[model samples]
Target: MAQKRDYYEVLGVDKNATEDQIKKAYRTIAIKYHPDRNPGNKEAEEKFKEAAEAYDVLHDPQKRQQYDQFGFSGPGMGGFGDFGASMNMDDIFSMFGDIFGGRAGFGGFGGSGTRGRQQHRGSDLRLKVRLSLDEIAHGVTKKFKVRKDITCSHCHGTGAEAGSSSEQCPTCHGSGVITHTTQSIFGMMQTQGVCPTCGGEGTVIKNKCKHCGGTGVEKGEEVVEIKIPAGVAEGMVVNVPGKGNAGKRKGVNGDIQVFIEEEPNDTFIRDDNDLIYNLLLDFPTAALGGEVEIPTIEGSKLKVKMEPGTQPGKTLRLRGKGLPAVQGYGRGNGDLVVNVSVYVPKTLSREEKSAIEQFRQSDNFKGDAATKHTIFQKFKNYFS
Candidate 1:
């Protein structure tokens, strides 16, 4: 699939555009590319939907903040499923018809004629899950018992009692909308609005379901399964569509937003995808280098060779030993960094001090100018 255009670019707005500005931009695009204006024009319809999608994200404070911080593929942005793409032309009309001053399917100014009843969308649900470094590295699936509104079993989402059915709304005569005609300077103009009696459902239940009180929904619990991608960081959200509260009166289900929280690990310090381990070595081990075992994120140990006279602040890099990058951000896994530190005794016994004094007197054991200069250059390089 082609990469989605940036939300700002799609609506031709700047990143810092105000809410009103964003709404104005979307309205302009919607009017220009409306299917009513360009009937059967697939490209125009796509652009219209694209503009709506952009407007949907930019107009909402929370979604806009997420988009600004993480871009298209960020957490809770729902890069896996595009919302506008999943909707139809009728869905768009029902959603934003009010924005057009009630001219959606009315008989004036590029109207598409009368449309079906409006369908309401359920509200999104938010959840937070804590993950271990291992789980973040490998990715995992989690199950949650979510408490939210669910479709009523007795009414079967129709809002009607058993052995009963919904009848045409008498106010609008089943049209789900009321058309108002007025004579103005521009001649006779007709605008449409949703019927107040039936709330745009076109039908009304004479006998309401006792269980859900005619709303077609009730409080319930659902077991939802979510698959988390690897390399996700804290505060990032994963969206599970159609897993939130059920919409009223057989409408669409909302989404489940999963927030990620990372659990701290005892052995490693995380630096993005990289892992940092501070290895403390004894004086003998630092002076006469050998192989030392290092812990890995995979719950295993890796043996690393230490060169003779290994100095403190020396870093050893093991390639492909770190965490993997989040999908679509980058490629390949990160490296493991080992920082070496040599342990020094606070006090020395008399015999040990005498042996150390003999070595201190030797030229080989005494620090030379070249050695001091090398050490100074290393420190300079490190700081630089």
Candidate 2:
């Protein structure tokens, strides 16, 4: 498949475009490429779907922020499949047909003159998932026991009970809508609205289900499994489509928005994908080179060679020892940076002090002019 266009680009708006601007842009594109207007034009249909998909993300604050930060590779983005190329005319009409000033599929400039009941989408569920640095380095799947609204078993998602069934609404006569015609200066003005008596549902159930009280849904619990992508950061939201509350009357199921929270690591400080570790060396180790073991994110120790005369503030890099980039970014793993610091003895024994005094007058013990200059510069830089 071809690479998807940027959401902002598809909507012909800038990153800073307001919500109203995004909605207006989507409306313009939708009107131009509407299926009713373009008929059998396959390209126009695709454009219409594309515009809908773009509007879906750009108009939402959270989704738009994620798209800006991680592009299409962010959590709950393009490939995860909520809405995009797979969107159909019915889905578009149901969600955005109001922009055309009528109920979806009802008679209007963009409608097909067919009355369809509005499907209620369930509310999204928000959850916070805490992860360790190791878990963030590599992707992990988690299972959650979510309590939300579910379809009523007794009614089987229909509002009718037992042997009783729904009958066509007498007010709209199964059209699910009420049309009004008025003579105006522009000629006969016609407008369509949802049926008030049946609440737009063409059928009415005389016997309501006791289990759900005719709502077709009830309080229930579900075990949902979410596969989190690697390299996701804290505050990022991962959406699990159709895993939230079950819609009323068997409409669309809601999504689960998983907010990521990262736990602090005891051994490493994270900078983006790179991990920083401060290694403290004793006087002997700083003066004399030695191989020291360092802790890694994978719970393993890596031996690093400390060169003789290694100074404080020196950094050693371990390539590919850090966290991996998020999928779809096409970036490699980050590095582990080791910061070197020397430890000084705060208290010394009598023998240790006497031994250090013997070397105090020695030429090797005393700093040369260049060494004094270097020390002066270090002190000046620190103070500055």
Top of the candidates by lDDT: 1
lDDT of each residue in 124-162, candidate 1, tens digit only: 899999999989989999999999999999998888899
Q: How many steric clashes does model 1 contain?
A: 0
Error of 2 at 7 (Å): 22
Worst 10 residues of 1 by lDDT: 104-113
Off by over 4 Å in 1: 1-114, 180-190, 377-384
Residue pairs in steric clash, candidate 2? none
lDDT of each: 0.83, 0.81
Q: Model 1: clashing residue pairs?
A: none
lDDT (tens digit, per residue) of candidate 2 on 1-384? 767888888889988899989988998888888876774599998888888888877776776777789987777664323465554565466556666656443223234545576566688899999998989988999999999999999998887789998899999998777776656323453456677878777788899999899989999898889999988888888988898888888877988999999999889999988999999898788878898998998889999888888888889999999989888765998999999999989999999999889989998768689988998998999999
**How many pairs collide in each candidate, listed in order?**
0, 0
